[model samples]
Target: MRFIPSLFTLAVCSSFSIQADNAETAIERITVQGDLRQQSLQQLAGSIAVVSEQDAKRTSAQHLDDLLNQFANVNFSAGASRGRYIQMRGIGERSEFVDTINPSVGILIDGIDYSGLGITGISDMAQLEVFRGPEASRFGANALAGMLNLTTKGPTATPEGKLSATLANYDSRQLAAQFSNSVNSQLGYSLALEQQSSDGFIDNTYLNRDDTNNIDEFSGRFKVNYHPTERLALQFIAHLSDQDNGYDAFSLDRNRNTLSDEPGQDKIRSKALALNADYSGLGFADFNGQISWLTADSDYGFDEDWSYVGIHPDEYATTDRYLRAREQITLDYRLVSTPAGQLGGSDWVLGLYVAGKDYDLNRQFWNWDLWQADSFSSSLERSNAAVYGELTTPLNASWSLVSGMRLERYADIYSDSSGNAIKNHDMMWGANVSLNYQVNNQALIYLLAARGYKAGGVNGDALAKAADGNLTELNSKASFKPETLYNAEFGVKGSALDQSITARVAAFYMWRDDMQVKGWLNPDSGPQFAGFIDNAGSGRNYGIEMENRLQLHPQLALFLSASWLKTRLGNYITLDGDNLSGREQAQAPRFQYSVASDWYITDALTFNLSLQGKDAFFYSDGHNARSKRYELLNARISYQLANWELAAWTRNALDKDIGVRGFYFGNDPRDGYEPHVYEQLSEPRRVGVTASYQF
Candidate 1:
């Protein structure tokens, strides 16, 4: 409550803080690299948030967990070993247990798909961009809602090397090193390696350990660029991440302490490679092509009962584990019309994309009797083929027109050891059209309309389990149909006060048909929960997003980002009559906001302060429980000299208890299976110091 006055003061002063500072660095024009071609972000018709390289380096971020509050309307699910799944605009998956999912928010690193793996390292990222709309025309169905892109640092014209280290409470530590150089005018490369580990915040009273939910992560990235001829250029990127973490999160008391005897693991090892080539030797058009491959192996499991045996009379003991392997390959090629190929003064682009992916999963469920335990395995193969194109032209002196379309054929095959075989195929299309009006030299107003789609998916073994239990009230459909979304948006964006201030404001509305909603069913009569997806008739979401920054002086800058959103679910009765009609969608908070200020006290001293808040939201579609509204504060201060720097930072400075995940279910034996609000908590107060040296 005290911070509200300070926020008002900063907001008022920032409006009048536009005085020119000769020494202050001008807010330069930013180009989004994820686009088909280089484009100025300020002039784009859609909404996006681009975190510059300097902003990433200014924080004590080791992985994605530390950077959540930096973006508005963005959230992540941490029910597993990692905070892996992400949500944008309250649209995305919260968890994955049995069925294959089509992600709403796509993720990419250097244009290679890494969706659902949200906890990537940030030590070497040059920039981070989050597009907050349906980008189907650009990236196809995977980008139904939007995309998260990370562009790592590229080779430098001059040779440079840096070493950095960090130490924090809870036995947290990290070490990283990076180097980049151009050997010649025709060749260049960059390489980075990092290792980070921490004794996570969970305390296990039964095991007498505080490191039960620990973290051990390693990451590396390498990139190279070569120009063999005057008209051709080639680039290559390789990335690897190995993570081994514990997942003893859920507690009987819904706090930091745990009593489970067997704490499960959340681990993954992934390797990916991408190659791209650009050529201009042709006369009619230029060629751009990309191909990539990714492979990953992961294991996720947890103790079914929150307490160990003997804690209660006749206590049931159980554990569940899953091992998954995934492989994916993708190719994208584009032809950009040269001046010679332009028709009627309009530039155009044509593209072809093909992707294939394979997923395999093995699950082990152990009950009290080893002979009665169950084993399950499943295999799934998915493929996508699409042809997409775009055209841009001047409609008038003040208004420009941009339109694009994509046609994709999606196919998948699934089978399980339980004699269940299912296949799904769908033909989907998406398109967008926009008109940009140049209001003046410094501002632009635009209106856009777009359509997006998500392919249908099967419920794996959950369907059979439901039928076996004769749960007639549960969703009877073995598979769900495709989902389509129609969106309309308009906004004004540009610079002001001689490029000292940058602001973007937008309002958007979206309508969904055949919406896929999450539901739960008891595989047996016991207190067990298995997830499934059911198609609802319709839904809608509308919101406004605002982001602003002002340079008060050469050494001071202030920023504000906020969103007001509303969502409603359609009438449907799945999950034994738990119809969530007319209710707000889960995880769709009504309001979210973040405020920050950066200041350089002296030539060698710097300070940064930030406050972030989010409104209450429902945890799941199958339950009525809601998370509490909460606010967090973070601060960082640094001192630098010639080629050396030292900094200290703290997150959740007030040590507030906040829930990251919540559920209303009955799991207690003593209470006779009475439902209670169980939750997984976020990390408590964390303080760390970092040092870096450059050579």
Candidate 2:
């Protein structure tokens, strides 16, 4: 079945039918991550990909995760269970908590950290930048792997507004509205709202339900910009989101599985507010500061009766609340500026960060009052401060060098379920060096290497296991050790054919220390269960990423991207004496690629087609592996009138079948040989129509 798709891909690339091959168009130069202004894709010095609002609209991307999942060079183990994580240069770890995200990858929106991934109100975004590798030296602690920056749209020059509605299969409906206006010359504001709901695609094998698998989400955002003067500006933004969704369904014959009780229900809500002030051109000095507050509450519960009797004889519920309040102030001073001279450009930025979070987890068994587990409460208080400076000097006409370093100190205090205190402190330093050479106005190449660090915390899995076993008390293992990575990259960006085509290629290698892996346990019960986290071993990831855009004609364009990765563990130490050494990483695949093309068929009509492919990986413990390769096709045809635009799109056009495999508990040890099952689950082939009007 997979071979047929491979042949089809080869045929498509081999065909000489130049329907619209090798075509690209030049767009405006945009500054990504609030620092560097990339004039063209060819001039970017790092591994970066930009998706504009126009691109988002053309693709009909409903969520941030959906957009990143289709892009090349990015892979994530995401679903109803595993939260979102950025996988670039092959570094990804699953962290299920909200107050702390083990993202080697960081996410930012308009210069503020977007700490919560479960909240769904990420609409009205103007641009999204995906940066990989050590280029994340500019962000905070969560940038060990990469960074995702989403910049929302600001007030328009005129009073511009849009209303859009979409209807799809599976009883799904979506409505969105955005309005922006200038209250006066110095004040402006924008407001947006979005609501979406869907009847899920999976059927619960136990509950025998249809609509019970549905999801509902609502989100809203408001932004106000005040420019008291040309050099000083103030921005205030607030957003709120709520979601209700069904957990992943269990596989058929789930009675034998330990965790395979009936499907669960999840309710999540979040609020974010930020106020920022920026002042520039202050006699060779500039300042930027912001204060933000974030709050998230989640409730998830599962009933354990539909599939099996006596196993998990009651309903289990877990509720968590996370609150984070942060304040950051930064000042930059520059003493030298020259158009063409050495030691002309030197800058320094000093920043102070104060942050604190309150985290609490509660668990209870409904039927058995004695078998209850709940957190009295827990809180993590964190604070950090840093000062960084960068100096860019031009050695000659075609050569330049940049050097920067940062010094930081951090402190953290954790209160356990009983309000017992645990404290830790650390001081860390980071540095970066980059050398660039420009061949011409349209080409540049550079070599970069930098180090990144991510702080660690308590092991939720281990704690949960010990608590369920009715242990008297457990001493906290001084939080997991921080994982660190050193990245080395070489890249070149260039354009040709009168700047109508742009291309970029980069090769990177990273060595990670103190890697984390999950270890499962064996239990004797109606439902067998136990699991924990361990610093299993070290790992290495190396990969090459390349993307190209060519403008073949005025009406046609072509874009292609592919990433080849080699991810593996260098050493292994098992917690349970399993001797599972020298095995490939469990859930990470080694190959992912994508291709897309756009054609302007007429003045008011356009067509887009794209295909994404992913390789296979082991399902269970790297012993019983199941191949998970699938090719997905998507297409959109859009039309525009004077004041309205309409699009008809189809996702998963080929209706490819995807399988998620897992293990099952067996009555006898011998019966476990064939107890593995494959759940033929998918998002379904969806056809949608969208209509939008502008005023």
Candidate 3:
């Protein structure tokens, strides 16, 4: 429980004897894509973390969620086959049901938005940047909590290729390949393909099957780059993915063994295309334009009863199914002036964006014993137009100011199968201001204040109707207010001992108004549960984070990262008149820490060890149940010879039983509806070998 002090002491002792050097290092000059332009990570006046391709390879992460879980102040809710929902600083959705949701965090892959559905396949990645706190000035409504920006490898002029395969415990297997080539002086291309399968950890006792919760996935990507002239560059990208995974997560005993005879399926198929152009022929600025299109079809269903009819003859066997198809198109145009050359001695960027989306959803709930069924269908159309600008100027030789703002107009139309329609529109804005000071060539400090917001929308669930059975009154209760936050932060980032040691420390405080909280409500006479969002009065959150990396010796290195957070609700009362004030938010852990070390035994052999831990936290706002704190230990050993490399790895070496997600409600009919806690556990200890070759 006292991980913060332990990590701090270790970092201090390791970095105390470092000597300052004048040589530049790779970490000091790392470029980050936090905004539209690329800048050194140290120059950014925010909290940011980056994971490189080399880091991904060393960890042997098969998906984006696996890689992200290693960082500080990050966690995932794993009810599905994989960790598809992400929570940062305790601000995100915990689960998704038969209703529309506005995500707090935003996810982008190669400039294409993938919010709410972030099943990103990890392959051929260049870098991934995680920006904590509010990023509304750059990303608008989707970034109320933060943003995750992912960049893939681009086309290279040299001909290169890679082939890799992995075999692991639990009958897991993976195959992947990548190739890049330059056809001529102006044309270059890159292609990547991957396929993976696994027999999941859970078992179904009634069906006598071990693969009820299995994994099968395939993904491919292609990119093309063309340079017609010195001032003009064009790039095209396409991606496709298919996934068919099982979802038999829960059981009567809250263990890995399930009794559901009718198992569920989690499937998704997606395609994306994008084109980007950059032209520097403008008189005083460079012009950039991008157009992108994406489509996804997903099916998520589950056996609601989690039991066979033979076991519980009196209870009705129930099943729930949902299907969704979505399409989106976006266009963006921007201009960036030459740095400190025009626009009144300040660097400026201006841009305009337009986007549209069409979404359709269908849900079916059936009870076999009673022969009762409820079917619902809905369609949603949305559009957005925004204008944003940023300006940066130096007030003194060591001090600089950065200011940015975004103004957006949003419109939505929702229609349901019952002939009920709702229309909503709003105009919102967000802003950011930061002042940074350079203490020396190796250190910098900054203070920032920002505002973020999420737009309101209509609810289409039939159970959301008014108790009075009045249509007009029902429509009035179907809407919720927008949520907003004001955040203030201070941080210091720098290198010490001649760039041999790097460290960053930050403290942040945030105030939220009109906070949106989601829960289910049961009416006095309804057979279905109604899901609704209410505007909670207010809340406050504060946290501190620290990270340090030290090169202790030529063959050894050490890294430590830790976070401490505090949260409190205010004036929020549930439907049962239960006061929620002073309660901690769900999924908001108090302490998280990660420590890693790497040793090079020889020119061809290396070893890595990592330990990570997360403190206990509440599972939901409607329940008092909490999860237990857990820790994991992992190790890897790799050997390299010419263009071939081999590695062996083990995760969760200590085999700790950590509960990643939990629900505190009655799930079994045998106990006569007595509520009990059910939990989904984290992955157990697994060992594997990976072999890769490059040319």
Candidate 4:
């Protein structure tokens, strides 16, 4: 609370000392793709943040997680080798086990879905947009909380190429290169490749290995654009990624040291292809279509007991592993009416979407000390079809009305090695309505109401269901109910000081019914735990967000963003007789903010500094454990000279102990079944230097 006043004071004081100058350029027009259409940022009704390629380079961001963590109301759970799970406004999943999960947030890269597996390479990205509310009408069930859209650099008519290399502490090395050009007047192409490796920041004393938790990644992307005729355009894109990383992170004493004998692996290999086409031959409307396919194979395993065999001779030491392979295909087609007055001064869009997914999982549990092994496998196939439409009409000179709706049908089939089969079907719907009023050329205000939906799925843990000893009970618990969200928001966007300053503020409230929540259950009084998903009664989340950018001078700029969130359960009760009606939702922080400043010392030199902070929050619903509030500092310096650039950067410059993930459960036998809090810390201070050349 005290920090809020200080931040405002600093902003006010800085404004007084800064003078506006036309010599410096301000970011006046930002184009964003939020609803499958490009719209100016100032005209958007919802809360969104955009990170450009220049910003990513200034911060020396190597992955999507690095660029996203600097924004307000955005956080990640890092139980794996990297930040694979994202939480927006405190609504997202932290981890996944045997049970199937419907992600609250959706991730898209060049129109291909990568929901739970967002480890795709982010090199040479043109821009990234983060939508902070339910995008129901645009994305349907996959975007209950929000969405992230990443656009890669497109092909250019002029030939150009870039090569860069980086070296950092802890034996880290990275190399990247890209080339784009036009082969002829009608065709253009682009290619990019990147490889990075590091001896990660963890020490395993038991195994005497300093590089037990290493990171190795490789990625490549190719894009081609062809304009066959004056009214037709076509594009093809392909991407491939391979990540092989270690996961020995936890320590008994909650520090940077581990004693696990069987360190685990977190690996993923993915390939994706997309084709897009547009035709404007019809004078009444424009047609656009996209076809995409993605496949990924992953192996995630971890040490069940973070200890050596001799530490607890009587207790069993185990390792749990899961191998998963997934394939997805999608087709989308839309037609947009051209000319505002084509249909009585109104604009409209109609779209059809279809998607199919196949997922297979194999789990293996090895009790090394006890010489026992258990194995299980499951497969799931899901299909979805939807039709959506939106209409925008002007009510008067200053007010406009927009309405949209989506109707979708989903079906899923699940089967496991235990001879259990489950089939389910659901019909989901989403809608949105908004009213916009333009106060002036420099300001706009809007109110929006939207609904979002997610389909349910069958539980994949066949062994746990069989252990219930009742076939009827097992069948009844096989499926969970769908979840829905209703959200309302009011927002304002404007610019001042001759467009030298731009700001946006929004407040939103969301009510969720039949909320899907995850928890672990103990079928018997043993050390084993079975994961399950069930529908809670209801929940609510309300929050306010503000973002501002000030171009103090041509050589200096300042940026600030903050959010305050509150979440609570309503009439929700756990299976263990715990009344969580009034309890706060897990991972819901009270406040989060970020401040950054950039200074150009000279025509060839620049410096940057940033600060990010987050308030304490609960870890999960099953436990009352909480994480401590923390802040991080980062700095960067760069020098440019005629097609060559050199930069140095440091992350976590202050070396703060920030917890990225946490758990509250018993794992060590020496503690005699006493539950304690365990946390995974973020990376320590890392210093690196990069050099790049463009031609």
Clashing pairs in model 3, backbone N/Cα/C closer than 3 A: 20-497, 20-498, 21-498
lDDT of residue 627 for candidate 2: 51
Q: Candidate 1, TM-score vs. the true structure?
A: 0.94
Local error of candidate 4 at residue 292 (angstroms): 0.4
| Residue 448, candidate 2: alpha-carbon lDDT | 82
Model 2: CA > 4 A from native: 1-28, 34-42, 79-83, 95-101, 116-119, 253-263, 303-343, 347-350, 365-377, 418-420, 460-478, 497-499, 523-531, 618-627, 659-682
Question: Model 2, residue 224: what's the lDDT?
Answer: 96
RMSD per candidate (Å) reads 3.5, 6.0, 2.9, 3.4
Worst 10 residues of 3 by lDDT: 467-476
Error of 3 at 218 (Å): 1.1
lDDT winner between candidates 2 and 3: 3
> What order do candidates take by lDDT, descending?
1, 4, 3, 2
Predicted candidate 3 versus true structure: per-residue lDDT over 137-213, tens digit per residue: 88888888788888888788899999999899989999989999999989999999999888888889999999988
lDDT of 1 by residue, 1-695 (tens): 34434433443343334444541344346888887765778667788889875676555667776676677777777778666677777777887776767888888998889886664678888888888878899888877878888888878889988899999999999999999999999999999999989889999999999888998989999999999999999999999999998889998877899999999888989999999999998887899999999999989898888889987784677888989999999999999989998878888899999999999999888632234688778899999999999898878877889899999998999998767788889999999999988654445678999999988988875665655455444436678898898889977676664666777777789998988888886545365666788887888888877678888898899888888789988876766667688788888888899888889999999998988898999998777899989998889999999999999999899898877788888777777767789988888998999999988
lDDT at position 68, candidate 4: 70
lDDT by residue for model 4 (1-695), tens: 45545444443343333344541354256889656556678766788899898877766788876777677788788868888777888788888777667888888988889888875567688889888888878887889888888888889999999999999998999999999999998899999999999889999999999887888999898999999998999999999999999988888768989999999998999999999999998888888999999999999998888888998755657889999999999999999888932578888889999999999999898632245898778998999999999888889988989889999999998888877787889999999898987654445678999999888988766344544353223443567898999999987776663656777777789998988776655544345665667677899999877788888998899988998889987776655556777788888888888888899999999999988889998877656788999887889999999999999999888888778888877776776756778998878888999999999
lDDT of 3 at 291: 96
